[model samples]
Target: MTTLLIRDGVIDDADQIAGVHVRSWQAAYRGLIDQEVLDGLSIPDRAEGWRRNLSDPLPTIIGILVAERDGEIVGWTSFGSGREEEGAGDGEVYGIYADPAEWSTGVGRALLDAAEQRILDAGHTRAYLWVLDGNERADAFYARQGWVADGASKVEERPGMSLREHRRVKHLAGS
Candidate 1:
């Protein structure tokens, strides 16, 4: 295995990131999410969205990091100020995804670690992220990293149905 490189993402990385996004969701959410919703995902559409996001990124974005191995993007994460209504000291991890093929190879961990550090540097002591309900793998992974659900939940509307998600938070002050 080659060394995994975690670096700041650029606009040129949008296409590859989109590929990772679709594939990761499809694999990670296979049994947890509705199959139809995953099936409806279009790489081109996702790529377009990513292009726009990278091009006109919000000022609050602390940074976006991509984990690459052998010149390919295997994982990525984005973090910044809390998008949701939260206390003043909370940073937020918008999302993190890794190609399922790279699962358990430390790719996601690299991305998470980088995001946490970036979030801390953004002058916030607490960090939070949301995961779809019943995503045991994701929840367990976050737990391993010291994240805990804050009892905050929300329902998200997708194409055909509503999905429930819960917020997990970590205190970065002493870590």
Candidate 2:
């Protein structure tokens, strides 16, 4: 694989990020989430949301990062202060996605490492992210990166279904 570059995501990257987001969800969440829901994902709608978020992020958003391979975006992540009441002092990885075709090619790992470093640089001792409950692949990936399922779980309401997600936490080494 060529050198993978991780950089701050720009407004222009919204469409590519949304493409990865939609494809990753369709591939990664297959069976775990309703097929109809995954199939219903709209890249245009997601791109618009990304455009809005990138241009004017919420106060809590620290940054967004994208992974590029040979000048094409293959993955992206967003992180900031934790949103849950129980995670007040912790950093949170809001979302991370790699193009389905890029899976297992180190894209996800690279993006995650960057996100962790940014969180640590922001003075966070701990960080967490949520993974859909039945995503064994993601569970294993996070486990390999030293994140553990901390027994925290929640059911999020989607369009016409509820999805269960479990929280995974990691403590930065230098903390």
What's the number of clashes in each of the models? 0, 0
Candidate 2 lDDT tens digits, 1-175: 7999999999999999999999999999899888988999999999999999999998888899999999899999999999999999999999999999999999999999999999988888899999998899999999999999999999989778898999999998673
Segments of candidate 1 deviating more than 4 angstroms: none
* RMSD to true structure for each model, in Å: 1.2, 1.0
TM-score of each: 0.95, 0.97
TM-score of model 1 vs. true structure: 0.95
TM-score of 2: 0.97
Alpha-carbon runs more than 4 Å astray in model 2? none
Tens-place lDDT digits, model 1, residues 137-161: 9999999999999899999897787
lDDT for each candidate structure: 0.90, 0.94
Q: For model 2, which pairs clash?
A: none
Q: Evaluate candidate 2 by giving its C-alpha RMSD to the native, one decimal.
A: 1.0
Lowest lDDT block of 10, candidate 2 = 166-175
